[model samples]
Target: MTITCQEILKTHEHLWQEATVHPFLDGCKQGTITPEQFNTWLVQDYQFVVEFTRMLARILSVAPRHHFDVLLGGLTALKDELNWFQVKAAERNLSLDVSKQRTCEEYSQFLESFARTPYAVQATGLWAVELAYNQGWQLPGHIPEPYTEFADRWGNLGFTDYVKLLEQQADEMLGNASPDIQKEAEETVITVAQFEKAFWQMAFNAT
Candidate 1:
């Protein structure tokens, strides 16, 4: 499965497309989600997000110094999201329980393990995350009610803001990469799109 970065990206694409795009669009249309529900979702899902970011950070640590900066930038964005999460929690007057860590999906476990492996392996995982973050901005448009709590909570700022930054970093990295590495990163983007779908599926179906 880890034969080449391109192969891994291809492996991850289809599942990703299906899982994320539909429900996200639906949620945006319904606009019934409340700030409190959004907070509960974040609090329940926080561990997966943090772990996911950590895995991406580990992958960034392995890139060539120039390329490494892009990954580092992505990590910074992830941290920014955490800050947003904290602020949102405070806004809603919700207490984040440190003891009740969220359960991770199997795919999340795979990402954490991939981050601990050789550089190439970790890089593949990083690509998935980077690609997803970069491309996810396109889906929010599908959301219908812009004024509802769901829209206010998710449809407004955080995801798109983070995505633009992620895309810019990806563009920089792609522009600077050597031919071989560039090919790998391209493949990584495709893989990430697939993973994005899987992540959404995990979220939608989570108990």
Candidate 2:
């Protein structure tokens, strides 16, 4: 079924809320993570994101012409995160290539599966990605001290623009959607969110 943008946003909101409870965030904020561990996590995250982005691009290919601008814009904004990942890799003296690092196998598999799947699956996959990335911005300020480091790292000035762009896209998609399209979008959002959380859980279990 074709998914609407609004449904995608709602599903993302739910996913972000769930992410707040993830142990990965807890571990980051708790300072339980060594630099090495953080590097490993970053590499795995990049691997997942790279594959997800390709999948999103494919889905965007078939997006409604009316919704195309916002959807593509959102995708473009997210590409900046790749630079962040590269920087993190440099700091850790690690390679950005997934094959080079001991990347999380489950996350890698999820990305590949999401990318290779039919366009019908794009809505769910994209929704999960949007929820996770955007939620990174909306997180509460009360994050534990250990995780606080990432607040600045992931929540930089440029990231604010990214958040605004994403929120705006979500608003536009939801606001302009027909009732039927909205429902489909929401379902996609929820499905994607489930995948988003599962991806992290997969990573956490990996460690």
| Local distance difference test values of all predictions, in order | 0.54, 0.57
- lDDT per residue as tens, model 2, 1-207: 434454455446656467545655555656565655666667777776776677667667766676576667757755876777787688778887655233345544555565454443444445445546545533644456544555665555655565455455555555665666556545545655565565545444444
- Taking all chains together, the TM-score of candidate 1 against the true structure is 0.61
- Whole-model alpha-carbon lDDT for candidate 2: 0.57
Instruction: Tell me, by TM-score, which candidate is best.
Output: 2
Clash count, predicted structure 2: 6
TM-score (all chains, Cα) for each model: 0.61, 0.62
Per-residue lDDT tens digits of candidate 1, residues 1-207?
114433444565565556345554455456654544445456655656677787776666665676665566667767877777677668668766643323345546767666545454345445456445334435555544432443444344555564455455455445555666655555545555655565544435434
Runs in model 2 with CA error above 4 Å? 1-17, 99-125, 142-149, 152-191, 202-207
